[model samples]
Target: MVLTADSYRVLRGWVNGLGYSLDARLIPYLELAGFGSATLTQTFDLQYDLISALVERWRPETHTFHLPCGECTITLEDVALHFGLPIDGDVITGVSVIAEPAVLCYSLLGASPDDTDSTFSKLKFTWLKANFQHLSVNATEEESVCPARVYIMHIIRGVLMPNLNNNKVHLQYLPLLADLHNVRSYSWGSAVLAMLYHELCRTTKPDAVDLGGCLVLLQLWALYRIPFLASVSHQPYVFLLVNRWSIYPGIGRLYTVLIYRLMIEQHTEEGFIWMSYRRPEIAAIIPSSSYVDSQLWCTNAPIISFNIVEWYHGDRVLQQFGYIQYIPDLPMPVGDVHGINKRGKHGQHWRVTHQIFVAVWENRMA
Candidate 1:
């Protein structure tokens, strides 16, 4: 559906309500990225990029099943089981409700008994189909796009904290979301936004905030099938702060450099900045010798090597340092240790190992 004037107004209102400024340069970047004009599509595209970046892809291991007729696929059933839940029904069936994976996602996270077929829900279904259609499995193919895991920590830090200004809401979801292994297959962004509406909007002043408006914008983006890019072409720093850095230590260093760059650009005084793992305790449980040449204190505590970068004003040099944190005892098996242990048969005695890097700056004022 085309973005009407009314829809644009609602979308704009939500963006403003969320305390996120539509970066002035975003429109030009969208045009450069070949997204047509500065229309609803572009707006939706930006939101999509932010949401996609925040959520981790669900890449589940699949096994092929050969049937008498043909080949069938075995996929996770968690999403289907959770879709449009609490509304009595064996299976989801309705004119509006389709069996598409994305539709199921919207239903699980966005749909409710009262507003099952809301405007936003319909729009989100269309967008999900359009955006991910390329990854859809063919009747003959055994491969399928697995459901994604919601990075609850990212959502709280990136989206809700900036707007809600309350940690209580974030605290409530922390326990449920922290247990990554058991999280449901649904849209994290939609779930959090829905909770925001229920917790703050419904019970308190309705007009106090535009939480509903924000949800509508998210739904519209999903409906329009827009592409999301987390970073602007000129701003690589945007990429570092938002995207996952666990895989790239170099990118992590670059992120540290970017923070310095911003400080240098502004000619600000020396100050301290740092980044750490979302769950350091998880690292504590795993054996350290299983992965790399890292120092280990004991089997109980995992030593995490943290890459540190330092910089000084007026000098384009970055001093590098290494810092380590001994995470206390939290015993937990990390799969078959043989695969991770590099010491061969003797490696069986070793524990699973993991490392994290943190960027820090210290400024002394005289």
Candidate 2:
């Protein structure tokens, strides 16, 4: 079962794609394993057997990697280490190599509070900084367009929020945001803003000063330039679905339907949009004729009413009363629950309820 030259080429391509060197070192391993003179099928079988043996010996499945904030997951970091690849540079950042167990404990649990000089913690911090720095910005003159700003805000609020820490990282990026604003690099500025929001949301016990700072920053951004909802793009809608947060509840559900029509039904080709969850339930609520409604759900009271009455009422009651046991039916046009008003056609009720449902479903899936 001699291996074909074509099979060798395919293996070479795979190794190169993984950022591994292909040289005499690989040749010896291949020949020693009988891959140098085997059929394509035989070569695959031999490689599978070798990988299985390595997996058994290494027990990578048993090793759990810890994140900076106490999250743990099984990862291939052990396998990467066993393969003698560099674990700290572009390799780790690009591939998202799991953190070593010790580093995770120190970063998340504060195992050694006084030891600020630990190598693993330093490495993790450096990796974080580098990854954010590497995010590409669209530096065109139209980068500050309304659609673009909304897109950037969605990315900040939804995608990057969970993994960031607000207290430490938000203030660190003030200068960068200021510089980007000065240069009119709205895309870059938006990225920094998103990072700040991400950190802000992660704050476990936010104090008055923290809330004030966040408010002030947000006000400044709002006043810097007015962002309109003109020229709706797919990115913001996709981010909204993926992050499951909407500026307005009606608007979010409207966007969900819009995304289904444009991306799923019409088959409009785009990146990022493909990765988002398709909310058919939302789409079902929207009338088919209103598929191209330029005003979105602003004037669609019936649909908006359907959204509130059908979906959000029960959750709103539970949130107020802590359980569904001692609650009255939600009054027409929802009322205030903890400063978030649910009444009115365009009130916070829609927004909050929609967010609650999205978060609940997302967490359940997770």
Candidate 3:
């Protein structure tokens, strides 16, 4: 059937609701995000198709593009360290672009071996620098960068100090608030969570890992700042959930559920609407090749990446979009173990059912 103007508009509206601005350029990326395949060749094509479309449409001549994480303060030293000595009154400190469900950045300074610990700082700096550019906070502006700093400072303060009368967490280190909004908190929080998760898997010490701590920290950051991500209907989390790792499915589910519960509780009506509409587009990012079933049973694959597919729906926003159900038992095929073993194909099949879920939320009006 021929695509109609109205139909095209509807689809375009669908894509924009996913987060891209309503423009022809974003169409290809929207399409790629929905394709599913189980082959490496297919994934490469999807990536290429979307990237090519963006490059062609935006036609960004400069090496740098606006970043989309958040605002922060970046010192002159930080800029120089990242991009080297000034070239023509400025140098490219970093480059950032949104890729599907997440923001990606490649910076010069943080690339150093010694700066491994500085990952979050670098990411935050890049996010702020990009946002500053977006807001036209040029170096020559009379208000200058200081005003911007103060602005972000206020936001950080507002988030951390929701109520001066009530003591929540220790806010003695108020200065760190600004740093937390950008990438620093997220990066460090992510790293800490990953390490803790790994430890949980390795040692089976869920009690010692403090899952709530990491979730609390991330939730606070996401709530107070990072509204863009917090606004998203689903947040992607990757973890191993295999028997060999001795990791229980419940451990993974708990963390995912915690994030959703806390985030939803914090959501304003606007946030809920934002998520409901965005769920489809975000859910569409699960590439066709990345099926949870195969990933679970696939051999020779690092179990981590496959697990990411499973946790994709744990959030409330996404969970609200869908439901999960578990079936306990089913009839087993009758056969002798030796006969089945000799055949090496199928003999007695044990009947078992796992959780089944669906996304039922309607897309918001565009």
Candidate 4:
């Protein structure tokens, strides 16, 4: 039987495979903001077929894969160990559309770009790259902070929390970066996973042509969890597990979309290393900070980013955490929550708009 358009998984790589280089002066600030472990020096293909296959297996209602072996997922532990990012603390939510985009940009970044397309709330990566690309060693502390913030903003828009805009990023996160000293406290890793989980759910809609929101993390998660799909050799483990495949030779283009779907559908529990992170060497590299909230990795809570809320049902995939893989109860009914987006949400703070989900996260482990 041939596949119809309705049954076919459309493949689309990141439309803009852009790269950015951070200035030496901004390193400390980025480190302070909890993204120092991540690097942007390399640009990567999204491994579209691989991502599409995973998305195809993703169950939106359950937020875990219904693979042949058993239910598994990219856990909060994976987000923490992979990126060395803070997983618990302040929620990264705010008004989706800033009422005064120029004011926020100038106040936080010390400059503003031209509002040519009325997309003022969404700044183009080109404008940011052109202006804040470089910072001098002699720059003042105040002078250095501006470019450093811009660099993190680029990471969010370009890499960590990408969206369909491809070349631009929403300014909702600017307020979060306004106070750099407090930035690291904002669970950047959890936010990345939330954005990714939502994207994985959306892509399963059968008509999604483009995938967004940290496809890199999704690919890396697949490589570690589904060893059969990966074709790389043993190498020294990297700190931010996200950086492990920076120099990887491609394994995606070797197979077609249907072939990849078949490989995943045929996987067995024996082929899966449920304890990949338990390796002593890898466990050693996971920073202590990532463990402060290690307990929350298994909490059935909502992982949230501004204007985006996705359920993180750690209780459902306990086997990934090395616990017994019991058959889970009926997956939580969150189909309505999955339908919500940032559209028509001007002047609304995500905390207020999405408080229902946020409350679930607030009382996590209750």
Candidate 5:
């Protein structure tokens, strides 16, 4: 797609609608790094730089990732050992394993942006194609049910939380456009962004908020097809970010509240679909009604429909924390809503059940 200045604004607004912002410090770093930067600049090369950073930092592992690849049998411990990286009490060092390749991809430019058939795009296409095929196969055959959910969640997670943690075995790389600008500082940011993005955009059974933190890593083969603007460039476009410590979009304890609010809205809705697989107890506490659905679909939530004015209007609670205003309340359905069937291993199932009490109060009527 021709991502123009206007389109960029729309994308930014979409993110802003969800209460996120581009880190001010990041743009300057882009300039300093020799990569040109602009608020609405349209250069696929620049775009590719961001995507490459993400693909580069990619460390393939099965468990330890919020978005685990069910198809892969390798555990996080296995991945660390395979990479010959030190695992200190579940933590991994040497980010260079991911950073170097990202930096290299950040610099490339010169190919025609219209070449949708370029090598990079081809890779992305192939990855997506394979994923689509897998999904189709799993849907057709119940035998692949477990593996299908695992792989599908992995792709969803890659889109959701694409960052690595400080720990060796922990999944990192929350995929955010801004995080992709600077690999080192924003890896976690990116990972969180991935989860947040998918949570906001993709909805099925549960309300968007409960699924907010969910994510999975798509295997490297699954990612090779997607193309970014930077693949055409031959130079690393300098990127920048200030105060790496600050989570620019302001995701923190407060952000967690956003997720809490969403669960409340979904649970109370009529015939609302709740996911009981991973955590049935928590799902049960959502306060079911006949209006809710027993099945969930990957659909967007209605809470996001709130007008900025209606969302921010005269609401003192949100006004107190100015940043809170940035996050708009997702609109709830006017009528029937579907709930999801929960699935996962016994251990995972109980883990979610144990957390029901925490979410139970969330549905209390004022």
Candidate 6:
């Protein structure tokens, strides 16, 4: 079974197309949760082929792309700078199997699905839109918080850490959003990266077709790092660098997936910009806020999100972080660990199930 370049292209339909109507009432909550930096000024489209090209280059064994230029993978710094999400903070883990999905929704989100299935932990995008998009004009502070939670839920379910269920959002994350004030404390960016890493690893199998993670992130990370793949951006620079590809057209959009695959294969080390973010012109636009805890961008730790655990190997790609590039040591052998997930092992707490990696994530001092 030969895995051709095209075999890796997993076709997907986006949930964000349901529309982004972030109510003005929710900005305060969004700002509180450190998500204010994520700008969704426009509803966007994704080229699955572009993402497929990058996946073809991804080496799940090392969790880095084996490009002609050298090993390069999306770093915590890229997640922090590009999306402005918190990278260094609490590990995002919780009960995957919510016993009472409807009750959980009603308690935190102020509403639940009309048709309640006892085993269902996922809510439809339309339900969230119908219940939360239009907050009451005279909504109380408490009432406002509910919609804010829903908005973040929509973002996560739609793009950030989406599953294969395009229309339905898993209700497991709703528990974490219970305290709107503390939402910022969780390392959402890390979890997002973890999910992407898992997706990259899964797609490497010849039979895998469906992908379930933030595709936008992988595509943007590639465009920003590879100077050749990035397009000329005339738009004024935005902090969360998603502006480059989200709202405006980029060079990758103009090329076919085959072209992108060929371009990546032909790429040489000189064409890769190891530290493009540190450029004077680029640095000038990024506000000081994004640099907080700049130390953790190179954390040599595991990026954990619930049952999913994937290694974040910043040491391997030191050059991308402005450090002198050296051939680093081998990737930690994660033998059967990468295959761990919340399948038949239902109703178990992630903290206990993934205790080993969670310990590494908890003691994230670096």
Q: Name the weakest run of 10 consecutive residues (lDDT summed) in model 2.
A: 10-19
Per-residue lDDT for 138 in model 5?
24
Better of 3 and 6 by lDDT: 6
Write one digit per residue (lDDT tens) for candidate 3, span 156-233: 222211222211211121222223223222211112222222222222222222211122222322333335334443
Please give, for residues 96-160, the per-residue lDDT of candidate 2 as tens digits: 12234345433332232234443322123232232222213553333222222222222222222
Candidate RMSDs in order: 25.0, 27.0, 25.1, 6.1, 24.1, 6.3
Looking at model 2, the pairs that clash are 1-39, 2-38, 3-38, 166-199, 334-343, 342-349
Residue range 231-335, candidate 5, lDDT tens digits: 322233311121231264432233222322333233223322122112455335433331122111111111110010001111212221122334433333222
* Clash count list over all predictions: 7, 6, 9, 1, 84, 0
**Reference-based TM-score of each model:** 0.20, 0.16, 0.18, 0.87, 0.19, 0.87
* Candidate with better lDDT, 1 vs 5: 1
Clashing pairs in 1: 49-228, 123-223, 127-222, 287-351, 287-352, 287-353, 288-353
Off by over 4 Å in 4: 1-8, 15-18, 115-119, 232-255, 327-329
* lDDT of the candidates, in the order given: 0.24, 0.23, 0.22, 0.74, 0.23, 0.76
lDDT of 6: 0.76
lDDT of 1 by residue, 51-168 (tens): 2211111111111112221211111111111111111111110122232423443333232222344332222223323333343333211122111111222223333322333221
Those runs of model 2 whose alpha carbons end farther than 4 Å from true positions after fitting are 1-129, 135-155, 158-292, 295-297, 300-332, 338-366
Error of 1 at 35 (Å): 26
